[model samples]
Target: MIQVRIKPGVEDRIRGFFPWVYRPEIISYSKQPKKGDLVVVRDYSGRFLGYGYINPSTNISIRIVSFNKEEPIGEELIRKRLKDALDYRKRLSLDSNAYRLVHSEGDFLPGLIVDVYGEYAVVEFTTYGMRSFKDWVVKALVELLKPKGIYERVSDYVATIEGVEDKGGILYGDVPEEVTIWEHDLKFLVLVPRGQKTGFFLDQRRARRLIRNFVKPGDECLDLFCHTGGFALNMKRAGAKKVTAVDLSEEALKVGKKNASLNQMSDVEWLEANAFDFLRKMHAEGRRFDLVVIDPPSFAKNKASVPSALRGYKELFFRGLHVTKPGGYLVVYSCSFHIRREHLLQTLLEASKDVKRQVRIVGESIQDLDHPWMLQTPNTLYLKGIYAEVL
Candidate 1:
């Protein structure tokens, strides 16, 4: 075992259960620290703090997985954590087979993500350290879930940053190219091998279900950045006479059309255009909808990108408001963790002031219950949607 000591004042935060230790906060190591080695963390005075895996090259150098000195990191501990996560989800009764099984730090299993879809599971390891426990993770999942197969989804950028191989494929059993899963009388075809964010945005299940309440029969609806038609299908199913789903990817539009056909909703209009351009076109054409959903991809990935990301969000808000009909509803979402709830609210306020339309907030929503967030790690609560009425 390797020993790691932190700087004088850094021990306070570690005692308070903050899981990350930045490289600058570390004072000394028992030896030259390896990139992905388990280490025993200690305070400046040589007091035990926690046990975690070390990534010496990154800014976030340490991610503590165990704070109890009695409980060491091993196969048994890993199995216990997996079983506990499964137990937690069983209690949620998410009403759908597709849900996040392991939410990284939310489950005290940093650097890993697991999403279940029907009889298959998709796993991702975001850190070089957690990659070492792949065998243990797979074995536990097989024993617990008894899924038909397990697939891996890896990000190229994360792989480069974490010094891991940038490869993705089936890790266990056999996975199909597509899987059909149902959610609240709705069935979605998940393209696990090539779809976005582990086949679907499972976190937005609540919002998809909630949007039905605000819709009226025969109302026109717009779903911008509508990847694979999650919101669009829901809007149409809610009795919207016409639904327009726009996305930049033609591939996604094809899938959306297929999804529409799957639900017998072939009437939905799939448009292959960038969301901003489509919004501008709608405004120019004097086209207005009863409900508009602005759910775009994360504009900011890290703290340094927050300012520019806020600017992008402000532009979307401005366009979304102008494109919405008077007395209609507008829903804007920011999936970036850096874009906090306050940031989204402030952006909406500024956009409203500029558009000269008084905005009335009707409802606010976060990621569904399946994606549990911890107060200690605000980043865990990444998805935020603001529903407002244009007065």
Candidate 2:
């Protein structure tokens, strides 16, 4: 087996059960190995630590597969990890047919994510190590769940960072051009074969349910950054007076309208525009709504950008508050791990003060139970949401 030695004093992180080994922490290696090679990791004192997959091209040089020295990284191990992930979902009993089954390191399976939509599963390989096990993992998933289809949604950065050249597509059974999924009794047509991040943002599943309950009958609702109209459809189903879904992707808007039609929901509007621009325009035009949902993609990918991301959040929320009627509901959410709960709360507070509006928190939520978080790894819990009333 290839040997990887950590620099002096750097073993504490591994000893504490942290999964990643950065390149700067490495002392030496017995041999230069190909990407995704299984290697034995040790401390500077030659003490055995764990086993992990190595990718020299990335700063995250190693991702620990097993801490036990005797444990092997094989088919059985993959089966066990996959089983654990599935069991967690079963326990949660999420009503939505579409949800995240595996959440990378959160599931103890680094660099891999699996989103399930009914009988179809979309897997994303985000590292060289996971990409190497693509076939085995897919086969294991097939043997276990026997889904009707399995597809791949590869991140372009995965190839650049991990030295993984392959961009993902169907690696197994046929994946339909569009897969129908259920969210709160509403039908949504997801373009899995060519859509964003496993075809939907399953992380926001529970939050959407909250929106459904909070939105009263005949209430005008606005879903910003509404990819494929998940929130809009749910609001319409909950008897909203009108639902307008806005997204930059014309393709997504087309599908969003189709999804509304699929569920036999009328009075739903679709707009293709930049969310930030649209919000500013709405504020200037004095457009007000009974309820607004702001679910933006991650603006903070790294620690350095977190402050700016929070500023962006504040601006968005402030604009949202400006356009919402007094006592109206606002559902704000952030998927960036770097944006902590306190930071989000602070941003909302600042936005409220800026708009001179009194805001009361009605509800707060984190990632669903299926996305388990290790005790020490708070970063794994990335989803944070708040339901506030502007008064």
Candidate 3:
């Protein structure tokens, strides 16, 4: 394996188990590294740091997989990691058959994501290094879980960034377009091939369940970015009178309608429109909801977009606050790791000041236990929700 050494002062972070090594952090290399090259990382003094794969062109150059000098990166390590990830999921509450089985760095398998829907599984290789071990990952999943099928869903951005071909399709067995999965008592339709982020937002399982507590019988509720109506169905099941579900994707809303009908729920009003415009229009029309959930997609994909993301959040909060009835529940979520919890809180405070509406935080939630994040790698803990009572 190629040996790579980092600059001084970077050894401490590696010692602390921080997985990523930036491109600029390197001082010297044993040889010219190629994309997706397995290399041994070392400190400036030539002390062994960790074993990782090198992506020469990317900003995040090396994604460390094994910190142990003895435990090198190989197929055995991949198998062990997948086994551990599955074990962690088994310990979690099995209320939903659909859940995140491997959450990239959260499971210490950086660049790899695996989500299970019923008896089938979906895998995504976001980095060139992880894609090299696709065969091993698929074999491990089949041997461990014995799933009916395993599908590979690679994104266009990942392909371009990692310099890998978009090889997204059924890796093993047959995968259906749609699969029905249960969360608590409510059922949802997961679009495996075409849906967002591995078909469903499995990280928000706890948040969706927690939403039931704030909803009352005959309460008017609004679900923004209501992909497949996960929150909308839950609110209806909780006996909400009128639930308005809004999303930009007509395909998502179509599935949302199916999910609502799957649960025998017909009171939900599904709308295909941009959530921001819809919220502003509703607020202008004097529409007030007893419960409102603004769970938008990641507004910030990178650090550069954070400023605009915060502005978007502020505007959404301003509109969301005004549309929510007095003393009603308002839940705002940010799935972007770039937008920290403090950012969301600060945005909420600023929006409250601008809108002249005070809110008391009633609840807080992060990614589900199945999607465990390490303290060293905060990016794994991407999803966060703040539940507040508007006053």
TM-scores for all predictions: 0.98, 0.96, 0.98
Please tell me which predicted candidate would have the highest lDDT against the true structure. Answer: 3
Residues 180-298 of candidate 2 have per-residue lDDT tens digits of 88877777888997888778877777777778877889899999999989889888878899988899999999998898788788898899999899999999999999999999999
lDDT of 3 at 161: 89
Expressed as tens digits, the lDDT of each residue in 278-362 for candidate 3 is 9889988999999999999999999999999999999999999999899998899999999999999999999999889989999
Candidate 2: 10-residue stretch with minimal lDDT: 158-167
Runs in model 1 deviating more than 4 A are none
Candidate 1 has a TM-score of: 0.98
lDDT of 1 by residue, 1-391 (tens): 8999999999889888889999999999998889889999999989999999999999999999999999988888889998999999999867788989999999989898999998999999989888888999999999999999999998887788998875879999999999999988899999998988798999999999989987899999999999999999999999999999999988888888899999998569999998888888888898889999999999999999999999998988998999888989999898999999899999999999999999999999999987888788888999999999997
lDDT of 3: 0.92
lDDT of each: 0.91, 0.87, 0.92
What stretches of model 3 exceed 4 Å from their correct place? none
Instruction: Order candidates by TM-score, high to low.
Output: 1, 3, 2
lDDT of 2: 0.87
